[model samples]
Target chain A: MSSCEFESLEKCLESHLPEAELTEVKHILFGKETKKLDLPSCALEAASERDFELKGYRFEAVQEQLRQPRRIRVGLIQHRIVLPTDAPILDQINAMHTRVGEIVEVAAMCGVNVVCFQETWTMPFAFCTREKEPWTEFAESAEEGNTTRFCQELAKKYNMVVVSPILEREELHGTLWNTAVVISNSGNVLGKSRKTHIPRIGDFNESTYYMEGNTGHTVFQTQFGKIAVNICYGRHHPLNWFMYSMNGAEIIFNPSATVGALSEPMWPIEARNAAIANHCFTCAINRVGTEHFKSEFTSGDGKKAHHDFGHFYGSSYVAAPDGSRTPGLSRTRDGLLVVEMDLNLNRQISDKWSFKMTGRYAEYAEELTKAVRHDFKPNIMKE
Target chain B: MSSCEFESLEKCLESHLPEAELTEVKHILFGKETKKLDLPSCALEAASERDFELKGYRFEAVQEQLRQPRRIRVGLIQHRIVLPTDAPILDQINAMHTRVGEIVEVAAMCGVNVVCFQETWTMPFAFCTREKEPWTEFAESAEEGNTTRFCQELAKKYNMVVVSPILEREELHGTLWNTAVVISNSGNVLGKSRKTHIPRIGDFNESTYYMEGNTGHTVFQTQFGKIAVNICYGRHHPLNWFMYSMNGAEIIFNPSATVGALSEPMWPIEARNAAIANHCFTCAINRVGTEHFKSEFTSGDGKKAHHDFGHFYGSSYVAAPDGSRTPGLSRTRDGLLVVEMDLNLNRQISDKWSFKMTGRYAEYAEELTKAVRHDFKPNIMKE
Candidate 1:
């Protein structure tokens, strides 16, 4: 078989003991009483037939007489590219559209009001191969992009807000950017926010394709709630998450495409820490499986040249404001994690933690201003 | 038995299944091949006789041809108050000094170049009581206080740097503050940095005693390495950690005294996350056992009044820049964790992660300057 058609799923998706052990351990952030929600047989059958994984969980706050619960169902979908990496761009996009459509249909059946897909869901994570020829061909307009149009259709059909992370090609400046388009439940494009941080380390030659985003931290006010997106590398910056929370975001989505070798250890940490720090619901979604590139690439480290970006290791999960979280999905399979969260918990945790009241932002502002100056010297107490 | 004299270790130290289960689970941040270090038998005997826990772990980095490894042994001590809350102030101070002296001796024997004690190590955590009589009497001069003098002697004896967090009574203004005094290996006081953030919620009536710290982020450049102290509530603020890192801290110590009901879940997360973000080694030290006050107090929550401040769970551990960590000490017992870390690993991981190169500090400085304004508006996009 040709390299494009040669599926080395076994070699790429090797399950080490640590990963299995981590999967079995229940984090203290999750409650002991947390149980799985029963889904319809048709949804289960769809996942079973397509060989994808489906997980559902519910988080409840203590009953309060002060406010009615603002419960919403959030759906996070992490999936593999439908076709081989060497396929035609349009054909690959179409195949991915079909795969995501099936998952969103299952989410709709489960009463999801808001759904989000992995980073650049319509294309394979080809940034590792850094060749600008066919990879840049995948960039399209954010407003009229084929991916956004498809997501808008699904959003209106299910009356769900869809957050679609994509590679955007600006027509005027001829510049490309990593962006997330937020389509409201009415199928109107609410807004788009680009990835705040572009990673340059490892096999992630993302800077070769796009630079830092220009659009500031934006919270999309939807029928479901105030949501924001911290696409991919933005997850590494706590300030990115803090700025969104400061903007009144109740839920933040982190659509990421990271391999297991470079980021698996940090996968469960950054987003969950953000949820705790910001007092908001955070959904972390990553694409599954490995995609072999047509050309070999080197990661700059003194290692053998390779054709793949290592395994994506999809283990998407949801973390709550109180630090509680749902168990993650499969590390080796495409999966959908449906989380039922009470928005009241956000305020409850905020009141309990009171990090906002005592944050001392003014002091940090003054310090940061001084720190950014050209003549800046660190506050190091030396001998 | 009187509540003050009663050491209900069995009842207050009860280990639920989840806590035990969490203890058993080896976090993915720690390497699988990490093994225990062989310490002098006298130190082990001291711990065995005193019934406190002692754990030692070593972390190594890949040998580089360019530079010799900068290896340093760090000791973190977490212990219960040596006497009853109602005991005379000087007597209690002496008792705590004796207890910590024993631990420091053991640490010195283990070749610990730098050793740190838990927050307010010389006194009971009496902020919950909010009674200003004997509790406030524990406050002393950060420079010449008995606690500082004691720690200075220890530093001189072992030729080790000592970090002692204490409640300070500033002589000039007669104002009190929570401070960490850094003592040089030569038994001289280098400097002091106060707690950046003061918590107002929960049973902590700390504001009634002391306000926020005035000293900026201070990194003490010792004979061993540059270190900073992010005392207690400062752990919750990511900016505090960032500033310390920006000041070029190699190791940041978070000496905290917090109870289980309000903060047990967050204990393992904040410092570890800071270590990952800042590319430094973080040593988290929390005191053990429950301290019952002489008088009852009510946390602003609508619960009944209580005489104790819940259990101060002691799960002290060390987190490296690469996200690998050592197993934490026991939750129920007084403990010391000695970590042998190669300081060169900090630069190596920083080179690998490249967060500093990509971090847009100037952009954030401008954003924060605007954010702290009176008429500042969050960059929120609405419908």
Candidate 2:
């Protein structure tokens, strides 16, 4: 066939070649006949180069290249505390300072730009079975408390963001607040967020000890990244994570003081979901070990004594934006977990997946937040 | 008092009471001298009522009750395919007597189980990309073909199980296999799940013509309690919605086709992580979407294509042990997804707070898997 005619015929075949015919054409073209086809010098040269072609059409190539530089190293200190409820309150506070300082030092050595400790890290879990004495002494002033100053100095020394949870002492009413403090690398106290939702279920009698946090969901701008904290029990509320992320928190930390029996299994899935849904990185640090205490007061459920000396199984971890987890640290041992991460990976995965971009957030907010009457039901079939 | 007795009294006061003052106790007890001292009687009565006293002599009551039971619903289905890849061969074989009949008539209605359809429910997805002419003919058997028979029958008769993806044969080898059949209660296929992960990174060149599935990860089991399907590509890797239980999932269906991402995503997380990590019901069905096309093919990546299509995303689901869905009909759409479930609030929320059972598995398995390797030097920590 003439060259021009051959080109037209090749295009025609390319457009309509059946599966069986394409196989035959491939056999014939790549067979001995490939040598016999006479060609224009330029066309022959081009054909000799390596490019994938079928009939006369070449396939297009697509490549995804990284656009930004994003790197971050994260460390989680999964601490275990067996607070002696009967032990003197001052002793308990001193023990926390010593133990937490050791972990902070270790995290600093690991080159972590930020280190997170579990909720209420400085006190024993006093909410499960509220005791009046523990509550009275456990509450500490946020600005001038010994724990806050100690952590601030550590942050200054290590040049890392230090997140510590304590029983925050409210000035006006003398009540306590379950609070998390985010300290900057320069020893400046960036901000503090109090626990919003107080749980009254199971042994979690939080309301008796502290009122809900007054500050709304807030994200702090830090040198490393915009960060936020969602204390224990707050993780269940999706809106909490959403609000913080929408305000531009690149990394959200959930530092919790909980045992394996109450929430360990949910750990692997929940934090990761938050990261994926919010398009942010998540670090969940949990306390391991058990605490035994005696209840000082009687309650409606009529529990005189509470002993959570059960294992605290510390499975601390970091969830990437794409829902993959870095290798989780141990729940058995008292140790430090460090992970090197790229801050850009969150943007890259979000750009490709487009969950938030494509999500119908406005509509959901309007529809979901409205009060559903007793008789209301969603019509799934309505197109 | 004697010196020995005085010293013993001093030690007792120092050890038992740290912050309490003797004056406060004496003032509180002085007025009760007129009343009879009945300490033993009070102690007996308190003990009988399950009340225990703390070190400070504060009375507290304890309630001992058996843990609540936890239950979840699950569903499963298995069906067959009728259309072979070769058209003339199919012409010789009557479609009425094929396996599709048993799926629509028996499996959909009488068996009425969690109706799982065979992979590539309509026409096979493997034909068009391969260089085979006769196989192209099989592509014409989609909507008006045997699939309609199953869809209509199950939609009307047994609307229990949610039917999975049903292939739709459009034209000659122009059919699409990565499709889902979501049948609602009124006997209509509500939506579809197009395969998202199209295997292109390996020997399987699934990108020749049929594009990758475009649907995002979504949950369908709504008030029916949350449930979702991670089709072939959806199963390849873990993503946000793949194993996420927003409220919670009674069942998760992973209908897969391939063995690796060329079918890998299909086999790995489809059954294992989708179930264990998520703590939901899960089922993995492989079509057994396998095909033997008589065509040699060139992959988009310049490799010789052997067998074009591996297997199909089969119909399988993982569900909570309880056969109950959150809240919906247990009817079959096309490929059945029937599950009998108890939707009691107690059963849904009765599990221990922290998936303790699930955490134990990760702990024991961590040694065997060695998922996190610590071989790399500390790049960021070095001065």
Candidate 3:
């Protein structure tokens, strides 16, 4: 296969190959062991043929004779938009649908019970440009949008839950929101979670397009497991991750589209820290490649006008409640990271750590309530 | 100097030697640049002679020229107790004071405005045995304990703010609390912050010794900077870190004594995540050496009873608000980490990320208030 000059052939081959063909990779987080899973030959071959990347890993819970282990396979897909930003909206959407379809088929072969796509996967990340004409055209209904309909079909076909992050246009009011629409395996729309936090940093003037989400931290209980979505910039807020876990989410997905220049170093840390702090599995996915816009835009930060956002480093990975995490996808490739997790590990870790028992939420609730008041005084000691 | 059979000579020599003798280490977090600082020859020579590890790094804000640079050097000392667990309380305390004094002299030579030691630095970690006789004997008054008095003297001598974590015996009630006393440069006790969260994991039955902290998140405003302490296990809770930042702490110290078998991986990620989330500086210090007690103890797990807690794993490091951090001290050595920070960078990063603006704390405050209620229903959106 012909590769981009920017892509490393060695990394491409490693993700495309079956685990058996690769060298052994052992992972230990706080002493919990993680093992890699070799994908089926059919899935590997499909990935090779389609020129997309696929890898799998497994996390297990200690065997308890009293209860059966609850195992679930989750897939996180990170990809670039198939077409250019200047392409016709429908054409770009359709091309993305087709590309994602091929990858979803491989996930089905790998027996992934749930799958998630990168943030606003069907469109070029045009929020940086701040022009509302063509970009707003990309927004659609959260319930009945074309992307949701497509994901519903894929979910039913594969018997897998699907989380699709898209720019949603409130049908009656014409309001735009960054939303993740969840579809169950039975092909029904479960619910939608909007991005709770909006970014105003660098070229990401996301507030210009959408306001903060009104829907609170929503954990969806599906056929496979309990899950929630913390979209993009919401990962920076620790309480955003905390509320979802408090809502009984077993797996929280952070589907983000952050660039390397802006947030790559943080990519590996935040979600993993969330998993450790909250006693739940966290999946962090970022988009790959750069998207050049039709017109030059200035970030207002004294830099020369540029046409493209910095590289959207795709290092999608999964972190377990025990702090063990799967190796991420290539920074320069479109890849699917499939992780098989024993859901019981969440309870096992919680039982072991007792974070919930020890977390002084009520104390902080009172503190925060007071802090928001005008007459509140912080406990600052000065000698 | 003769080294332990387990430690590498190369690793030992690196920390003992000055920055000029070692390779350069550059840190970048979310695009912020961090530079290493060279220590004075006198301090380097003292480190080599006294044989304790020392290293320094610096973080800077963009040259705004609007305000003078708020440059401050903070030091974190992670050390092993000089005397064994079986040693007399007074003797052990005296020996610890002497060893830490030598380290503080080096820190003073490096121009550290503030310095903190590991959890209960004056005593061997004896909570694992759940013994009260000799261990409770180590507990002293929070306001005028022996450890606090020694720290006050050092603080006055170096004109440095001192944070000393100790087992505090409340005078009125005679209750024991794990606390950190903050001493001002003028040798006055500013205040004390206690370990808000107690661990019950593995060998840490800290509840057997002390209850949760009564002091709210206390930020001590000294002459150099505003600082706070999150003693040991409190680092696992993100809100604990958030509360300190909310109280206007520019730098937070996590004086910890965690073992490798249970928390090596989390050691690096948690404090760094707190810095990124809180838009502040965090110095995480963990004690070196495995302290063997005279008596064996069982963790109630299926494992055999043991005498020592697993390796303390000293890899102490400092993290900046922008996510950059210095190289940590060796895992098997007692060391002091000195980080030169631009306190203005805290405001710079907060302004840049806009985390505080978008945090939506009032929303979570309401959510947490509801969550602590008896009849509260979580926002679980299940089909």
Candidate 4:
């Protein structure tokens, strides 16, 4: 494959695959892990391969001194997109795959320990159309999906934990899911979390395509950090975040595809709230810019059919356990935000908040059991 | 009794009470409900017995017209104090009682239908001192406490729903609770909700004072609105908010006594997040200024004994169901924030966000059942 010759992520993939027999190849990496201290540390950056492009990038570091250091450098990539309106589904997938790989390479070069992408990063947010013809073809298997395979190679090559969010297994029928594929630094397919809360409002008629997730809140204990993915609309659910926090997630990524008018006001709130309440680092990622389709569709409102789903303002930011946040990325620009801080901040913050120990989880669980009763009796009164 | 000598709401009370045996007295209001065709209209302000103070006041009207307007004006009052440290318990109680009554007058004059005072709004936040003797004397009955009677009179006087959060029923045995007394607009004692989440960290050793709530999340269908109070520390628990929302709380008041350094950062987050998630208007009230105690105590740290907790930082604000927020009250001054908007905004925002309809509650209920299981396994992978 020729290096540095491609204009987009799709062209980068064409050099690696002949298109017909791509499944015969498995993901493998040749780059060595730059040996450094295994624990989260401020001095964890090591350059095993000195590429000139990579050498110039410096990580945006949080200067919080830790009482007991467990540092992890996390990266979140928010990409603006441009795809020809008439492009085939395969070409679109190839473009996304190549773009994400490039972003991961940049994150790895900046010595990011773990990286996460936005929700359904491979394709445009097409549910607004509600006409489910070609969009269904974008769904692939999590274990051997083209997106997963592409990420696995990058994960192994960079020795970085990768969270690849994609639409999964939908084309065949009755098995579609919005999933986040968690890959270990060594290219092992660790686990996947499905989008638990499917939004069914306005342009987000996601329930038409995907049901609620069957996979419960799963925290992957990767080599870099213990992470969980609360996919897209799941960001609205505090219980979704609480369950992950209960399962001992040090970091939770909310990869969302929300636009300005539908959810912009709510964007800055939910994930940061989850971070503070759960005492964990939270990464909120959104796709940037506008994606217009060749076909226009009706919103059932009798208004003129529109091609775009509004702007997916990609103001991605990471919130620390202490309720501090890194500056948000630009709304209209494609950018990668790297946040370096001590993971032990979780321990300190949790110790201060003491929510896990003080919270009446068992009691709440009991009430919830009663609340879900078939003949629900509300404990409410009126004069 | 000279009627004009009494203050705004207090004078309205004198007309009903006659300064006689008030227990035998059934409250008769001199005011009438000026009903406007509801769908949250700013023109709903109709005064029956208009004092100059009340006539001059108007609700902070939102211009958003409603399809089916169910309008209600909510008020949150935050107060500051420098109670004489050497004063007797009754003196402190009287001091707080008089101060809050004045604030209630302002709220009533503003035509606020529901008013919530800050957490334990009566006395100094003496819990930080950790001294058992004097503070224990402050706890009173949820039903017939001195504070309840004071609020009950005010509630009937102005036909205002009153939520009075207080240190309750602790002078005797183990019956102590951090509770909010809900007074119906008709002066009926609505059911109370104890603080569900008791914090147990640093200076907030509240578990030492009160156990978790047993009343459950109770919503009262008041004459003005369906309301619930999430007392102080319970604000940290989203499930508490969720349960209330499930029970159809249109407006949830979070009366809190949180100080600056310990929880000021979280103040803006928790209630606002709840408002968005639950599709309900949320009122977050906090005590203002610093209150000093006569005695000094250790925080269990090696530091010397301290005379006061940190600043209360009264930044009480109202968050709309649409994720918009009322500007917060001053951090260092006593202030009352009046939020007047359409109650049907909940219906509109919920229709837009549809988190209630689209969110997979039952699915989550089933999963949470297993999640709280003793033998639950985390979906995690490790090397």
Candidate 5:
């Protein structure tokens, strides 16, 4: 086939390439190219071995013309849990496993190579008003934690990348950290990143529950494009987002557990802003469903006092690099939101905006570092 | 009167202090104080010329009890206008004056001390695609322009500080500028500011319509507070907003003709980001409604066609420095949005965020100059 025809075929194939289609295409193309054998003979032998039906299309002929490597189908699984804040921590973990397992199965059936969860998906928002026991019991060792083991089996079963957030416990330091563990399709732990900024305002008393994260901004070299995870509160700080983008992160996941009313106004603003500002597609997954937690309340008479639990409103969503939101998952319902996106759209947007090419990063660093100093006065007098 | 009774009266007089009703005991004591002041035998006799109304409570009595001046009610008028792309230049100008007059009347009824309009309120957004006729009819002089005369009359009738945006024509150089003129309550022109940055992408073809604004960032001192206007498209350049905030501008206005869809998503994000980043209250006024203009379109079938004018989704809003939208005006809406704000709130928010207190302006200046150079590269290697 001519190069122009090959290019057109590749583009057409990419348009509707499903997860399961990828594996079939890969096996047929690889076998034909490596063996230098007839495409029809290789396909018939491979199809028989795999018990696969060729359907109406001439699979053998189509395989003969294929030249480019088969692309993998990756799916993101962003979900929110609906558990009472006072429920047993173990129950929450088990519930997460069941739900995540179901999502993994669904993605696997669709032939997705990877599935990702939001930041700290297994626990209630303990930072929203510091309470002691929740932190003590919620923290778990990264390597041997129950959540990790569950994710491992799921990953191995589906043969997909399983990215999950957990309350990481440092055995030596006796402290907790907000972290994400990337388990390979083979169930091997690839690596993990600890959240950088620990917010300490409003309901976010993260500093009291755990120390600041140790890992700086980083990107993981997945089979897909270079991916990075910026935990919940870190999205508010521009420097953190910039670090990952400047390092060439094409797809960044911001798995968050924010609810409506308190931080909800900021929810629609932050992730989209980061996407546009950094020229990267960002998936901001917010936990759905309310978690009732008992808290002290004072009455109007100044004599009455009671304990109450407030509800957590959930509305998780994914924002494209061009600033359009995929139909957001219901804030009140438990469901999965799936979207088919062109990874190349990032390049198209970047070429148009040229934020990376035109961005003055050196100047930003100087201004940011100086902005943190208490005594550094602004030069208002100088025009 | 007892000190506790005097304190209650003081609290009641301070509007922002949270209004409270005096107890029966405190009322009795205050009545005694009023009686003591009213005694004819007392050396301090009431003037016969004084037309004081004693409805058991009076302004003089409240003033005497509270030593501090009453807080003035400041209102922010966020105005937006829909300019038809196909309409004649003079027709568009006439439409803007009528729309502005209606908004001014609304501001007067709301008891607003100052009504600030958006940047370049006179013309349709010609910057999107530069057509020369629009630039040819640019307002030649700020003082002698039609926009100025309209605004001056509105200011005189309403007794307000009217901020009007116009296309300033520089007669000597035959150049045009994006300028904002501040008119006093008595219709006297106070001062004017030229926009600093002219954006080049999307619909902002500012460079084609007018020369880059030459004046450095500065604020206009008004009776209400130190205020400044940063015209549309300037919000993207952080330094411009920083310069205004650093100049003791308690309140800054970002008046724009930006519509929804193409750049609308960026609208909600940029203004609030600027408010939080700079630690200043920002009022972002966007023109709403649709305009029709015929644009030549080249089709794939080789037929030339025309596209109708675009729609400007108006959602004018005010964002507090802490990034909170005021109660009623936060939503995306059209019409006159009246927000009663405490000027002192700016001080409170700035004190908390300390953007000015901690900002390192000198270091940023050095870095910005370096960044403008073509060869500067980011040092991403350093975490």
Candidate 6:
């Protein structure tokens, strides 16, 4: 039996553990549910009929799209969770839900059609600890999780597609996954995709928590556009992005939670490479502020793991297919980046580059066809 | 049998056309032999067991390599051939040859063990004209051509490996190939690799000149390191870079003659991505200055071609496996950029990232095995 008794999640963890009735979150916070947001008026440049601009970051040189422009307003939220280690995981998540509600209300006012959060946004990143007892409390089913329910309410209220990246899912009998769930604007449960690539280097020993994703490059169709989610580490794989493009993704969202030292220099690079190579718009989101844990740990390299894991560097930016980029959001502060792009730019850039016309997929198909055999050798020079 | 009989080349290109014997280039420059170089003392930062620095660009934060730092000094030369369009092709080539000898001597004095010249270093990029009369005269046999012989003498004298990209080889059979001949440090021919990808867009209508490469990814072994050349257009393909990495190429050089408007925006991007993704060093070289032809042509985009194509933008650069890059050479001036790197950085980065270990080749093989089927359908979500 588990030590804590909170909700159905506690029961889901064990067949023999005692269960407790779930509390209604709205019943706990009655007055704060409808709280109004007070923010800068022109902070958001909505995707209305006329062209718009904001102070810090603005787009440049809009080219004509092949088809009529399918304009959509997208909001990428970067937030850092603050909670004590000993605090109940349920209450910690509740605090995050309240903050997200405040941001989503403001995004609705700015007319955002879709919003995405950083990887495993609902809980703190505890994979570095390699401890299972405390972290397992955060995992919930995609269908009945508290986060899925919270996002569904916001989706219906604001008529926006919400891409809620959370630590989800069932283990392959004994493992957990870093997953992202897509909720449609109509409050329907659209599908979910897992993180295909896992990192095992210093500070990012993610294989301790989740294995490779089982989902094969899934994209969702909402009211606004065809979109795909390439979670954190998968951004390193070009073919991962190409699969989404072959499936016809106009916009790709890479929700990541990486620190400064591990990849700050590369933050501006990988996604932009994907946008150029795949001829699609890419939104790269990263969490802000420094994350600290209760105890120091070792990084498996005999070095002591400090309490703080560096700054998240929340410099979220959007890149178009034609290589044009919007100025990044503030690197130090919490930010909600709202970007507007004509979806037709995807088709136009693809037409001009002629990559699909001449990609010679047949050639790659033949090469990969031979590569999949169990005895396949990658180095042909030796053969 | 031929209109011009200047040398052995005239006999090779003549059937029924009026001919003249080709002139021996060494004979034309009667007294002008190979000159020695006079440079500063610190210009040659040889990998002689000491850390060094140079003007224009320097490396940042050198990490300890997994093995001994297998440092090699490499130089990439970006030079433009200058002469009037009506000038004889033979004389124009001789001018380029004289200038190259001077630059190469300087490179050798600087302790550069391996050097690469820009695409078709001895000839004009006349593909923009779409007219084929004079450009065909630049074709030569890779086995015993004049360019090959000139590079052989330089290689033997300097004890350096030379990669000479040229308009080679089959004008007799009504076809021309964009090829690069690799001459060993001992001056022996070390095979060749043809350009794989062909461009058909505006300004880069190279389909008029060559067929796709019949040779697979070929890497040459030299005293300094194993090297491969991905001739200009192949840089756009990530798979091409991956192939070279799989074949064990430590340094891959891309020799190109692209203008500013078409690919300048992409210049800083693709090569860096290849270096990071493949865990290898990449050297990118492009010709400088604008070349003009006597006749105007059409781009097939309904726009008539002007006398000059856009600027070649000679910003040659080198990128390390860890994503550190040397400052690019001058965009408008001819330059020779020499870079020093530890070959063991490749193994260290690969070990740290472990992409090859966890890349799930069996998984990708299964996916690609299915993807290559003629009736394979991409995963698309319908509304």
Best by DockQ: 3
lDDT of 2 by residue, A5-57 (tens): 11122233344445544433322211111112122344324323412110111
Write one digit per residue (lDDT tens) for candidate 2, span B1-383.
21111211112323433233422221111111111112344333432342211011111112225533222223343333345455554442345234443433433322233454544544455533544344334332334555544565655665544555644454664545556666554555555555555544323444443565544434455324455565654543433332234324445566655431222221322244344334455556555334555565554456566655443333233323211111111111123233433333323333422232212222212221221123412111101
Q: Where in model 6 is the C-alpha error above 4 Å?
A: A1-66, A171-174, A300-302, A369-383, B1-66, B171-173, B300-305
Q: For residues B58-136, what per-residue lDDT tens digits would candidate 4 score against the true structure?
A: 2222345535457677778787653675688888888878776776776676677888888888777778877777887
lDDT by residue (B1-383, candidate 3, tens digit) is 11122342224334433342222111112224456699999998998898888888888887677898889999999888899888888999999999999999999999999999999888998998888988988999989887888888999999999999999999899799999999999999999998999997766779999999999998998888889999889999999999999989999999999875457667778999999999999999999888999989897788999898777878788888887777678767788888998899898989999898899989998998998887878787667
Chain A TM-scores of each predicted structure, in the order given, are 0.92, 0.76, 0.93, 0.81, 0.74, 0.82
Off by over 4 Å in 1: A1-35, A63-66, B1-35
User: lDDT values of the candidates?
Assistant: 0.83, 0.50, 0.85, 0.71, 0.57, 0.71
lDDT at B40, model 2? 40
Q: What is the DockQ of each candidate?
A: 0.36, 0.02, 0.46, 0.23, 0.05, 0.14
- Which one is best on lDDT? 3
| Alpha-carbon deviation at B149 in model 3, angstroms | 1.4
Model 2 chain A worst lDDT run, 10 consecutive residues: A52-61
Tell how far residue B142 is off in model 6, in angstroms: 2.3
Q: List the residue pairs that clash in candidate 3.
A: none
> In model 3 chain A, where is the ten-residue run with the lowest total lDDT?
A21-30
Q: What is the lDDT of residue B130 in candidate 5?
A: 52
Model 3 ranges with Cα > 4 A deviation: A1-33, B1-33
Flag clash pairs in model 4: A40-A71, B38-B69, B39-B69, B40-B69, B140-B169
What CAPRI class is candidate 2?
Answer: incorrect
Superposed model 4: Cα runs more than 4 Å off: A1-68, A170-174, A300-303, B1-68, B170-174, B300-303
**TM-score comparison, 3 vs 5, better candidate:** 3
TM-scores for all candidates? 0.92, 0.60, 0.94, 0.82, 0.66, 0.83
Per-residue lDDT over A245-265 for candidate 5, one digit per residue giving the tens place of the 0 to 100 score: 766676677877764333555
Residue B322, candidate 3: how far off, in angstroms? 0.5
Give lDDT tens digits, candidate 5, residues B269-377.
Answer: 7667666656666777665444444565332223445342345544455665655653222122334444444556555545543445434344444444454456755
For model 2, the local distance difference test gives 0.50
True contacts kept of each: 0.51, 0.01, 0.64, 0.53, 0.08, 0.26
